[model samples]
Target: MASEGGFFSAVWETIKTIFWALIIAGVFRTVFYQPFWIPSGSMKDTLLIGDFLFVNKMAYGYSYASCPSIRLQRFGIDVDAQDICFFLDGDNTRLFGDEPERGDVVVFRHPSTGQDYIKRLVGLPGETVQMIDGVLHINGEPVQLEDGGQFVETYERQGPEGRPPRCENGAVGPGADCIKSRQIETLPGGSSHSILNIGDYRGADDTGVFNVPEGHYFMMGDNRDNSLDSRFPASAGGVGYVPFENLIGRADRIMFSSAGRSMLFFWTWRSDRYFKAIE
Candidate 1:
């Protein structure tokens, strides 16, 4: 009888330890950082597909979107941020809120789908943003763009989606050098970053000026031609001006990066990108 009691006590102790560990991890994720995987090439060259980073939740303070959303399909767990912190929804306000700066790489909740998206903040509230002939214009003035040569990659299926990259040279067969024109774009206030251009006068190359609404921000991707960003309306399957409340966090660095389909493949890791700072 004593042996039976001892076995139950050990089991209970193990369960208690696991429960506390989970609680601590949950608190850390909610209050500090959240892990994010780059699943698309929209922000390529700056953030690549298969790159893993931690979003700093404290950067812009706490909101409902700061809550962790777990969606493991294999486990049948589908919890949304709203499910955990629904009481914080509806109001477009945040606790200890701080306005995001221009040229910041930010992750926010999609206004329509509630999914997460990462893009560079280009237009602040009440600023006019336009893309005139593939050049970024702010408040009717064109920002500076200097030639930065070409960005090349192998013309093969990339990432888990097996999508091929579009090339400026166009229609290169597999195993050839796929290239896109690269430029150093300088935003207002001296923030500079690399932007890619595949072709001239393509879709979204020239758009009407967008006057960003108050309490909202305009975002774009470094891979200009491929990104479905503020240039397209949310109703048209694109990210429109995102509200301040939907801001999840800031991506400050790349914790890990893999070039292959699965991150578990250690041979596919990009050793140089480990612990790399996000520009």
Candidate 2:
């Protein structure tokens, strides 16, 4: 009887430890940092698919969007940030908020869909943003762009989605070289990053001037031709001007990366991208 009691006590202790550990992890994720996995190539060379990073939640203070949303269709679990902190919605204000700067890579919640999206903050509040002939213009002044040679990759399926890259060089056989034009774009405040151009005739390359609202921002992906950003309206399947309260956090670096479909595939891990800082 004593042995049976001892076994039950050990089991209870183990359960308690796990419960506390989960609580601590939840708090850390909600307050400090949030893990983000790159599932798309919109950011391209700046941030590739399978790049895993922790967003600094304190960068822009806390908001309802800071709450984590967990969705697992297989488990029939769907909890949105709004579901967890619904009362915090509709305020459009953040606690201890700080304005995000141009060129800072950010992860925010889609205003309409409530899905998370990562993009470079290119336009601040009340700024005019336009893409004229594949060149980005802020307040009618074009940002500086310099030739960055070419970005090349394998013309095969990438990441878990098994999507093939859109190459400026057009369609190529699998395992062949896929290439895109690369440029170094310098923003107004001297923040510079690499941008990839797949073509010059893409629709997003030439867009009407977008006047960013007072508390909203204009975001764009580094892969200009491939990104469906502020250039397209939310009704058209693209994120429109994202509200300030929708901001989640700033991504500073990549903690891990994999090129394969599964992170468990050790052979597909990218050693060079480990702990790499995000520009």
Candidate 3:
């Protein structure tokens, strides 16, 4: 009888320890950092589709969740219910408020879709943003641009006959068909990054000047011609001016990356991008 009682006590202690451990982990995840996987090539070259990174949620003050479109989250968390009870009842809670800079790469909840998207911060709260002939212009002044020459990338998942995953930027020589010109464009604060220019006229290439509304920002993708960014209207399938409150966090560095061939295959891992800092 004594031995049985001791066994039960040990089991109870283990249960309690696990309970507290889960509670602490949950709080930490909700407050400090959140893990994210890049599923698209929107911020290509800087961030790839297979890249995994941690978002710094505390970079900006948290805002009350107002998006009604987040019904089912990936972790099975009921974000809608949580927002309704914890954030939406007129108690707009925030802390350590800070705004994103011109070149900061950010991951945010889409204002309309409630879907998360990653893009580079291009326009601030109250600046006029426009793109003229594929050149980024801010406040009616054209931002500086310099040719950084060519960038060629090979697809690990390309088909045998160079079929499905053809390069959209442009083909290289007759042998290699994936090459694009990488241009260096300076932002307002002298922040620069590599942007791809396929030298093609796109719908979002030339856009009407947008007077960024108060408390909102304009974002664009690094892949100039292929990215569907703020230059296009939201109605036409582009992310319009995003509200500051919807900003989730800043993407600082890549934690890991894969080529989508297989996660279990160690050879398929992108070793170079692992733990690389985001510019």
lDDT of 1 by residue, 1-279 (tens): 999999999999999999999999999998999999998888978998889999999999999999988999999999999999999998888999999999999999999889999999999999999988889999999999999999998998888898989899989999999999999999998888898888853469988889999989999999998898888888987899999999999999999998999877779999899999998
State each model's CA lDDT, in order.
Answer: 0.92, 0.93, 0.74
Ranking by lDDT: 2, 1, 3
Candidate 2: list runs displaced more than 4 Å. Answer: 200-202
Model 3 worst lDDT window (10 residues): 157-166
Q: On TM-score, who's better, 2 or 3? A: 2
RMSD of each: 1.2, 1.1, 4.2
lDDT of 2: 0.93
TM-score, ranked from best to worst:
2, 1, 3
Write candidate 2's Cα lDDT for 1-279 as tens digits: 999999999999999999999999988999999998899899999999989899999999988898899899999999999998888788789999999999999999988899999999999998999988999999999999999999999998888899999999888999999999999999999999999998864578888989999999999999988898888899998999999999999999999898999777778889899999999
Q: Report backbone clashes per prediction.
A: 0, 0, 0
Tell me which of candidates 1 and 3 scores higher on lDDT. Answer: 1
